[model samples]
Target: MKAWFKSGAPWVWLNGGAVALCMIMVVGLLGLIAVRGFGHFWPADLVQMSVLDRDGDRQEVLGELVRKEVIPARVARTNGYTVAEDVPLVTRYLIKQGNRDLGSDFQWYLDVGMGEWHYPENAIVVERREWGNFYGFPVALKEHGEVISRLGDEDFWPEVEARVERSVDLHNEIRRKEKVEIGSINHKLERLRLERRRLELQGVSPEEMAQAEEQFAVEREALNEEYRRIKAERDAIYEQIERDSFDVETVNGMEKTIHLHNIVRVTRSNHLGVFGKLAHYMDRFWEFLTEEPREANTEGGIFPAIFGTVTMVIVMSIMVTPLGVLAAIYLREYARQGTVLKLIRISVYNLAGVPSIVYGVFGLGFFVYFLGGSIDELFFPASLPAPTFGTPGLFWASLTLALLTLPVVIVSTEEGLARIPSTIRQGSLALGATKSETLWKVVVPLATPGMMTGLILAIARAAGEVAPLMLVGVVKLAPSLPIDGNYPYIHLDQKIMHLGFHIYDVGFQSPNVEAARPLVYATALTLVLLIIILNLTAIKIRNTLREKYRSASD
Candidate 1:
């Protein structure tokens, strides 16, 4: 053992252990994320279970339960209310309020054929066939069951259409009332004008004209008063109707009524059977990465966040790569090691260690408020006071990340440059090559592997970064895509979605945190996979560069 230790086996063991630990950690993280994430995408059936409450009379009050397919209802007793033990019951929907044990009151049965489940307090049944949502409507089919059209499985379009038709009728009625009032006012005014004309033709005495004028004035006053009254009434009716159209209370009431017919029946899909499943899985994947802003879950899409992350990362890479390479080149070829250079190097290193949040603050103040605000004033004078770039946006977020990861690329490129031999430069120059040509053709190519290494590292780090992006461009929900149909097309000032931000939003910020946990994991896995794909591509390029430069280095 002493000999082995002397031979450096102890150090080898220590290094090996560290390497194994790191590998384990990475694999474990990936496995956890994948299991959670992919599990969310797995095909699920809509399982109907029975929720029961034990009344004070010891009789059970049964409640309708809806859940994903095949979820076990393992019961446990709780404060007063009985819930399905193993069943993942959505308490918000089933039980309005109560702390009750889940095990004692409710039982679960898996029902495969029937869309509804009714439990006789003693037995609960659950079952499954393929189920999914289509055009914002939940749908299902029983195993080997014929397609049947069930009532109330249509989109909010039906309700919206009904509301719109009613609205049109109401609007016409209002317009009719407005026309009647306008006609009445016009008729009275015309009558008064006719009377005035008659008096004018009669050449009445001065007192008579005065009294006629006074009579006309009183009639005019009454007409104005009547018109105002009619206008007020019309406005009140219109406002009330408009308010009711978007009324939360009315909408909720309608939703509940519609939900009563929210039946999931076995229907033949327009898509082939497996295709439906695939589509369903993709929808779940999208949901894992994003949340719908509306109850219908149709108004929002994933393109915004997808575009934001891609655009920002690409923009950041563009800004950072050349600057990093240039700085590294200058340091390696021009600057001599001295106090000033050392101090500069130390400063660069220290900047990398600065907390990312501090960068966000700096970006908010300098990039957003100062620089962006200045540009807005100079170029967009018409938009005075309200600066476009001064808002939190993709441009600022990308710029912040560019600054944050500048050190990584710089350090890597410098190390790559340092690795190239002085002999190669001398040989190139001796061969009558210009300094720029030699540096570009020989040195840079030799250092390609290292440059890619830096790029890969930078990409990985940037992809995982959330804090700076949060303050700069990320939003919980973006109303518009980063790239859209608007003028100038790419709206850098618009807020964007990010996968990392989505994970945080679903995991910690969601009202239903526990239910969203699996979704969070899936989103995280998707991000991890993207980073891995990027790293793999970089590695492939690095290997190619290394092979190409093998002879040059030797």
Candidate 2:
């Protein structure tokens, strides 16, 4: 063993073991997240259970059994639960009885208190827009408050499904008219108003100003008429959607009337086979990726967050690459190798080590309050009091992230420049190539792979960062995406949603912790996947560059 240690075998083994252990831990963590997160979408069996409480009162409970665990008898007893003297461990279950509007959705029951438990074929799980979930047995179907048909426990599902589908379609149409059609009209009207104000500020002639005002009034009148027409159509659709309603008997023997418009999906969880459940899982997973979030971001999809994250990263990359590359070239090629150069290098390295939150504060103070405020004051005085550019937004957020990752790019690029053989420059000079031409044409080309590597690292860091974004542009929810159909297309002044911030909000700030827990894992997994994809794309480019340059360098 001593000889092996002296031979460096022990250190080699230690290193290999450490790498293997890290791989195991990472795989395990990802596995846990995937199982817990993705499994939430699967159509678990709805169970009807009879329970005898500690007070000896009996009641029927209906829900999906979410988790089961064994607890120490001592701990169970300490929690005021009675445990059998012979039993050293007590089993308990967590039931997701989702109906936030009714009462507590999550409940725990000791196995001792649980009586007969079985999957009832008629039990239904209703996913709603406002409430978390509703689990009960269908009783009847009504049309406009009138009972059209009474249903036996198992007979109502098919009708319920059909009506729910119609309601969902109508709901989507209503949303489109309200959010897209009316929204576009509203945006255009606001822009016209802003334009008129801008023309007035530019000191237009009285005749031009009158013409502009006349145009604005005409446009506004047209837009208002269109809005009224759409509003009337939307109201008609809403009335149609609200016509159907269903009655369900709760586990506690209370009947509640729920409108079909309010229900997003109704699943007969107890009756679904494995393949049926798998299909349901796929459908839900797709929706989670594509739909806008509702219920304080605890329910629905994270498309907005995903879009914002990718957009910000792209913007940050665009801002950082040119600046970082230019700075690196100046420092490594042009600047004299003196005390100033050394101090600049030291500063770059130190900047990389500064706590990220400090960068956020600096960015807020400098980029938003100072630079942005100045831009607003100088150029957008017409939009005064509203503060167009004088706010945390996509532009400032991207710029701040660029600054934060600038050091990585500079260091990587400088090192790449240093690695080229000095003989290459000498040969280029001898061949009558100017110093500038040689540097740009030969040295930069060969260093492309290294620059890409820096970019990959920068993206990996910037995409996952939340602290700086919170101060700069990220919000719990954004009303509109930064990119839209508005003038200039891309609105840099708009705040954006971010996956990192979404995770933070859903996991920590959500009011419904249990409902949001699975979302946190799902969002986290998505972020990890996104980073991996970006890094892979960069790596592919780097590989291509490396292949192209290998022969030239040799």
Which is the leading candidate under TM-score? 2
Predictions in order: lDDT = 0.61, 0.90
TM-score of 1: 0.63
Report the lDDT tens digits of candidate 2 across residue range 1-554. Answer: 88877999888999999999999999999998898888878888988888766666888888988789998888877877777788899888988998788888898888887888888887888888988789998889999898777776454667778899999999999988877898898889888878988998899999999998898899999999999999999999999999999899897879999998889998988788889889999989999999999999999999999999999999999999999999999998999999999999999999999988888999999999999899998988778878887899999999999999999999999888988889999999999999999999898998888788889999999999999999998999998888876677899999999999999999999998988999999999899989999999989989989998887767
Q: How many backbone clashes does candidate 1 have?
A: 29
Q: After superposition, how far is residue 107 of candidate 1 from its true place, in Å?
A: 13
* TM-score of every candidate: 0.63, 0.95
**Positional deviation of 184 in candidate 1, in angstroms?**
44
Tell me, by lDDT, which candidate is best.
Answer: 2
Runs of candidate 2 with Cα error greater than 4 angstroms are 1-6, 72-89, 152-155, 551-554
